[model samples]
Target: MKYDDFMGEVQHRLELPDTGRAVRATRAVLQSLGERLQAGEAEDLAASLPMEVDYYLESADSGQRFDYDEFVGKVADRANVDRSDAAYYAKAVFGLVSELVSAGEIEQVRAQLPDDYEDLFALIDAEEVEE
Candidate 1:
């Protein structure tokens, strides 16, 4: 999707008041996800996303490893939002991403993460089942 469309979806999905919030949340989630994923997987995911969104994933340090709580904390810090809001943002942004990317890619991302991370992707899976 185009940048505008991508942000629009994020805004709608998150029920944010404006695109600015969506942008911050999206950047937060993508950057955190980039840090979690291996360099090659990050590169692959970035390649599949819009150019604007892809920038968030570029040059991520693949060596750093953290669990779900730490991931949420990092997102909150980077997004300058509260922890609760950060978790919601992660679900919204990642749900949109799961729709945009391939199933295999989603599985690849899930494999890198712990079981706690499954809750985020479950939002996507639930939506798919509803449709």
Candidate 2:
């Protein structure tokens, strides 16, 4: 979902009065994020993005995993921000595109243990070796 929509839904869920000032605040936050992302400042992004999502999510539902669409709708409604903005924010947070790419190193060394690996301990036969 767009950033505006996400903020709007969050605002709505939180029961914040939807007003012009609230909408402006949402836009300003999103615009600032865009600027940061454009600068390729990844560390800063990692630190801030999740915190924002967590704050909004917690404030809205007090620790619940609402559907992406539902959260977006509520935020959009509350913040009076455009749905497009909410969509943008959702894409950034939930799209998983960035994670998939950045986490390539971890994907490279991937391995799956055989189910029989657990049997190795039983097969050690320590008693037989001593005898």
lDDT of 1 by residue, 46-87 (tens): 887899998887766764688889989988998898999898
lDDT of candidate 2 over 21-76, digit per residue (tens): 44444443333333222222333223334444323322322223334355455445
Leading candidate by TM-score:
1
> Least accurate stretch of 10 residues (summed lDDT) in model 2?
105-114
- Counting clashing residue pairs in each candidate, in order, gives 0, 23
What is the model-wide C-alpha lDDT for candidate 1? 0.87
User: Which residue runs of candidate 2 sit more than 4 Å off their true CA positions?
Assistant: 1-60, 93-131
TM-score, cand. 2: 0.27
Error of 1 at 105 (Å): 0.5
Cα misplacement distance, residue 67 of candidate 1 (Å):
0.4
Model 1 residue-pair collision total: 0
